[model samples]
Target: MPQRSSTFNPHDPVTLQRMQSARSIHSEIMGCQLRKKKVLELLPPFGAGKDYPPQPPDIETYIVEFDGADDPMHPQNWTVRKKLRVMTVLGFATFVVAWGSSIFSPAIFVISEVFHISTVTAILAISLYVLGFASGPLVWGPLSELYGRRPPTLISTFTSAVFHMGVARSDDLASIMICRFFAGFFGASCLAVVPASFADIFGNKTRGMAIAIFATCVFIGPLIAPVVGGFIVTSYLGWRWTAYLTSIMGFSSFALVVYFMDETYPPQVLVEKAQFLRRETDNWCILARQEQSKFELSDLLEHNISRPLKMLFTEPILFLITLYTAFIYGILYLLLEAYPIIFYEGYGMAFQISELPYLGVVVGQIFGGAMVVAFEPMTYKRIVANGGRPIPEIRLIPTMIGSMLFTIGMFWLTWSGAYHRHVHWIVPTISGIFTGMGLISIFLSALNYIVESYLMFAASAVAANTFLRSGFGAGFPLFAGAMFKNLGVQWAGTLIGCIALILVPVPVLFYLYGKRLRTMSNYAPT
Candidate 1:
């Protein structure tokens, strides 16, 4: 104390060293706070940030330096295990969403009876559900990109569950129908968010598996939902159980999402941190470029709002694939509605037993999922063998094989039902298996090619496809009753098969000339 000197230099080496260390610590603390802010926003509650400072350059520096993964913040660079967990959870959420939409189809009769309504109006529930699916994704897909995947997903799912509960409790058809539409509107959140999420987590090489898993579930969900719902309704539980069961599934999915799924949207994560840093440090400069743009809200809304229509109009590959997929989906839905009428009413198969025919679509979907999984590794190997660059046409190999079987399934199911043959019904059921397999295979390939050709706008492109696909899915059933009534199952299915036959060459054409077409087109991703 007595040796203390007033003349002491603050720039003395010891003092300077301490000062430097203090600044360094302060900067680090600031960064940690920023990162924690992002972690809270981007990750669910369980993945809270540890105290350790991020061991890299600033967020922007890392974003650029690591090329993409530097953003240790990126959901894409999330450890393989973490990413897989997210996909599984999100995939299941997707399952529940589609499950809710179609779970009530077979229960339509029960609903009709309960509401004392015409069968046609009861079926409105199904159509309105699909209609919600058709429209909701247009907004949700882009919004998730702007906001994080979590908030929209949680909100939508929770809202959907609440609405589904309403559907269960409603006493009248109009109330139920309104509730059903909103339920689907909320659930459609899963579809819009899942694909974009997959693109966020997986890279080009392994995306096929991610896509396969997701697309397989989306396609199979409806098929399985009706099967389970049919059994539930026929088991004396009644149609309302369909709504309750779906709500339970949805709530369970929400729990899983809250636990497992992390934010995959890059912009949202950055903006989250930007928001925190700006608030805490009171330094506006702390905001990231994306956050600094005051137009973000408007841009986000516009991007989400415009994408579906934009992709539909601008991209030929997206347009064509959407058209093709729409027809396939439409027919699939039509068959879902008509099968009960044809096999149960006309052929006298018991409702419970008649559902066994759906085993065909289920079997086919399993095969299709396998084909897609198999196709991916094979294509990757071939590309690696051929000096590492993949040809767009390579994707068509599975499509080619699947389409043939698809055509066969259509003919088999159509004619077998039309002739009213007593061949154990397993014949058409097996055909359904093949059709499902083929349809999914082709669908995966088509979607992959479209996304590859439209990376930045993949959400929009998919939105366009979903719009058409669900539109057709919703409307197709309405026509099924009339078509079968006038044309009979054989001619009706044959007519659809003839259309599919026309479509068979589309993939082949794309396979052979796809690259050339994408290369020449203005917006086809070249």
Candidate 2:
């Protein structure tokens, strides 16, 4: 019957009307199916009902997405210069927050003298700031996912600057502690969100180098802080200037972000585009798929707040990597205490001079970053060979190498500093290079691995990692003095080294079995 109709004239009114009506219906059905597919793509695979409620069938929905693979509005398609501008702002924000964590560390003694508190109690200035890091991520990570990177960054950074101002203006220890903790609470937004931002702008081919640069900033900030803080504390500017300077930097970061940073998260970008489209077309039905989902407080608590902790416990890869990185992070902070003991007390160096040794670690971090950058071509080759799919385990190779270097550095510093009276101060300081390289390598690898493995859920994974690592960082300094004094530099360092040695197999095991683990994971891409 259709074949018979094909011979009919095109100009026949009934035939033309019927054909146009059929085409219209077919177009509407296809459009509906396409929108449905996109909505499904946006919804969380598990518990989609709880997270994103189903839209009523009576409503016609228009889902907005990138124009195509080459959409200029997409972060992935942004010019290199634009991405770097955003990254520069984010990286500086990360550095400022990390620098804030330890800048006050050099002022502990001054704080103790002013407040008539023990050095141990004064250490709370740093500890509380780091502890704030742990709590801040729980809020910032979810908010970033909900609202996008820019809002949380601006709000938190500005608030953090105000709190830093409060710390600068405080007259009492209680006020200072409160201000410091809140500053960190806000500042931790950078730590929790920046890595995810990096993942957004950089693809798999170049992400390792980008993350290496990020990890270098993270590891080097505290190291650099003691150096800068030592100068600030020892100078006529005094300890308050430490807070003042950090505040200035924080404010600067806020300004840069406000002026330079564009929203990078794809879903949030689509939401903005959808809003613009709705305005132009006067069609309220047009919406980003993410906008269709109602944001419930209960859903936020269940998915955003609790999910990271739940993943920490349930995911072997996340838990082990978090544990491994946390321990290294703790030792890094512990060195804030241990370095002074080793160099200042043992070798009779001045406080500021003792802080100079941290530069060795800084140099090592540079080397570690170079190492990661150098490996990028090889990784790209492997990715091409594997038909464009990246292997998460390949990221762990540097981690394995870093683990051994970490252990080696620990023992080297332990023995050299144990004989501080006999050994040249340079001996122990030289160990910092190895420690720094190892630290950067391990941290960079872990971060990239998690991002690659988890894909969309990277922010939550990083928040979990940050939570544990900050806990260790905050706790380690409190016991560092006692441990170094009681166990002696040699034994205490040996203890840390042995633990590091135990964790050395983590990357290796993951490298071998990561695919299997990822295949079984509920959240990670298989």
Candidate 3:
């Protein structure tokens, strides 16, 4: 009855309040609808099949996404200065983790003497640390996907630093082994996640150059570590200083990361934005597509935990690439032991001086990276010519070349250093340049190819690669002493070189058939 009075109610507080509330509710509902529309338009279609179970029909949902292509929040749209700062911090983090892997090499003798363990047992410190690398990526990879790059990187690196400190203070072999393994496990985060972060920020055209820089940091870390660790071990500061030094570097990296790093993962960013919008609007329906599904332990296990393993086994591109990278990584670690045999013992060089040869490998890595960077413009032109879509095979060119160089270096180092001891020491040491160049070239190319091929799944693909390579890395050094000692450096080196030669065609095969394989893959972009 009162509704019949449609006029003369301007001064009535009750009527005005009711009318204002109605308008406010209508505005909120319209706003949500418009937002949902914008989100759908901006987002790529989820395709026919749904990844998550359907939401209840009765509930209205508003998805949150980047505003548009120019959305500054997008990682790709971040300012070059900020991206470079982030890259530098990440590069350092990666370098520190890698450095930690081999720093213990120089301390092996000291550890053997102090702990009254065999040289082989003393080597466990390095082996276990690398083994940790194998396992850490399994968890870190999934966590990076579920959370974001920054959190996993910070947590793992900081924890690794703590473990390094644990190794530093440990008095017993058991304690040392545990600490070293855990340190490596935590340190593996940088290996598993940094490449993905690089991919997140850099577009395909420039990603190769970024990955090349990353590869240099990676390979150079181990190359430089022994030099530093050797001096530290031979000093009054003692072998423990090696672990302490790594811990210091780790902490420094963590500090830098805390100061400079921002979330680069686009999905995670959108999820955070959605959470912020929900808080501001007091609307529970505002959700990121990533947030649409309720968190379940089963989903996490099935999707995040198992996906990399599944992809690793199922995808040929991933498997072969991982295998090749793993072999190269293994050889790199094996050289940690082999170099000492050839230089320190065989060549009768001082322990401190033997470590210097690693610098040759470092130089080679720099050249390799430079080569990849140099090729980026040509690749970019190809990308442009192909209508702005990158062909993953184009990345394999360097790998093909590097494979031959790696094989050559392997033979040169082993034969000259082992068989022709009278040959100048520089002969063997200089060979490191080729090995280093080949190592970095193959590594950089494989990584760029993986990132381009898998796109959104780059993290998992990389994790799979890391898992296999770290396994190789962990195992190689354990056998290096015996293999080089028994097989003689020449035969041992020849064996590895032969393997490298056999694998030479891997990149070539992929380069020729990669497109077809990608088209056939479930994980790779068609």
Candidate 4:
């Protein structure tokens, strides 16, 4: 081989070609920056000595980007303690709002007696409260997208507290119902936003556990509320104290959130970061959240409100899951109506003793939540590791299990609670465990499936879920007394159980055909 020459030629074609390639890359990178307005701090400095020299332009770029995996600004990269704090606040807030709904169940009879209204009329408070849950998400979900999660969370929680206090102070039934509805409407912010917040911070592996925990609190709150409310209603403090208690709890939670929870929405954080960078670096090219910041009131109503409704009707998967979840939710509240009459008339128990039966459901939910937390993540991680994508079908397995349990539980509750043959109350209450197990398992699975499938439109998908389930939850109580009275406990419960049996095939069919359905879907993640 000839000896290599040490001198480099300045006019070499190869060197010229390399220079041209570098310029191309530089232009593409600059174009990316201008289009997204993202500050890509990871890029090499454009200096004379740099290998891929930046092209000379009117403005020099020193865009701020996340520092690899260690960027502190990234919510996922925050300290584990910080993530836990966020979870705690969100979980507690969800519990408080849920409690606000059912705490009034024990008070319903009291309100009826005081106002000389019928039982069904009194139940409108609970029903309307749940209706607020359904409606609020249509508005709040989009607001979270438009603003930051933190602002929506704080504003909603504070307004809910104010309304809770309004309920406490109200003297008339109309005023109480109005206050309760508005309280629930505002407090539903957590239902709409917190799940997405978890998605913002957690990877698939950890999100399963987080969802299980959050969902447990949600299911458990309403279950436990009757117990607490039962005691409060009978106490010297009376029914209004329940609202006062909720107000105090809500306000306390609001303060905790204000102090601890930082903004978690990635786009919002990026926008703030861009604003800071623009101020620091004096660059006008960075435009953080330009699109979101421009949304006006009309735009918010149309996109956030109308879009979810459109999706609700148009998206088949969302529609089916919502219907299924709503049916189970309706039955759960129906049980509340059925339980009071059964215990009061059959066992001669006061409202406090009657509410004791709800604990069984609470225990079952805890069991269901624990099971989901324990094993689902292991299997989910295994599936992902074995070359499977995070398909929505992964969640359907639990829904099947839950549906079967729900069916059995309803029939069991029928035999134990509705029968004329004298049976101990513990038997029916024990059956409530199955009800909780099935209800919560289905809820967790469906929720996880929706979020995983609708990653891009998770908020809108959740709004649909909220709308249907809460709608059922609200209406079911109104008619539950009538159903139980007309059909008797056995047939009434059997009817619900039969419906649940029919729906068992839903998740099963979805498990088999979900991918194909997703292929046809406009919103589902491919």
RMSD to the true structure for each prediction, in A, is 11.2, 10.0, 11.6, 9.7
Stretches of candidate 3 off by over 4 Å are 1-61, 419-421
Clashing pairs in 4: 41-65
What is the Å distance of residue 68 in model 4 from its true position?
Answer: 4.2
Indicate the worst ten consecutive residues by lDDT in candidate 1: 62-71
Error of 4 at 240 (Å): 0.6
Each prediction's TM-score versus the true structure: 0.83, 0.88, 0.88, 0.86
lDDT value for candidate 1?
0.74
Model 4, span 102-212: residue lDDT tens: 998999889999999998899999998899999998888766765668998999899999999999999999999999899989988888788878776765667777877
**Local error of candidate 1 at 518, Å?**
2.9
Model 2 quality (TM-score): 0.88
Q: What are the Cα lDDT values of the candidates?
A: 0.74, 0.84, 0.85, 0.79
* Number of colliding residue pairs in model 4: 1
- Kindly report which residue pairs in candidate 2 clash with one another: none
Say which prediction, candidate 1 or candidate 4, comes out ahead on lDDT. Answer: 4
- Tell me how far the alpha carbon of residue 61 in candidate 4 is from the true structure, in angstroms, after superposition: 6.6
Off by over 4 Å in 1: 1-72, 272-284, 296-304, 382-393, 520-524
lDDT of 2 by residue, 1-526 (tens): 1211223456654345434432332232112233456566776655644554565565434765454445577787799999899988999999999999998988999999999999999999999999999989988876787678899999988999999999999999999999999999999988878888888788778888878777877888999999999989999999999999999999999999999999977678878998988888887778765565543466567666777788888998899888989998998899999999998899988888889998988988898878878888888888789766678888888888889988999999889998976899899999998998899899888888998887666777888899999999999999999999999999999899999998899899999988988887876765
- Candidate structures ordered by TM-score, highest first: 2, 3, 4, 1
- What lDDT would candidate 4 get against the real structure? 0.79
Off by over 4 Å in 4: 1-70, 289-293, 386-389
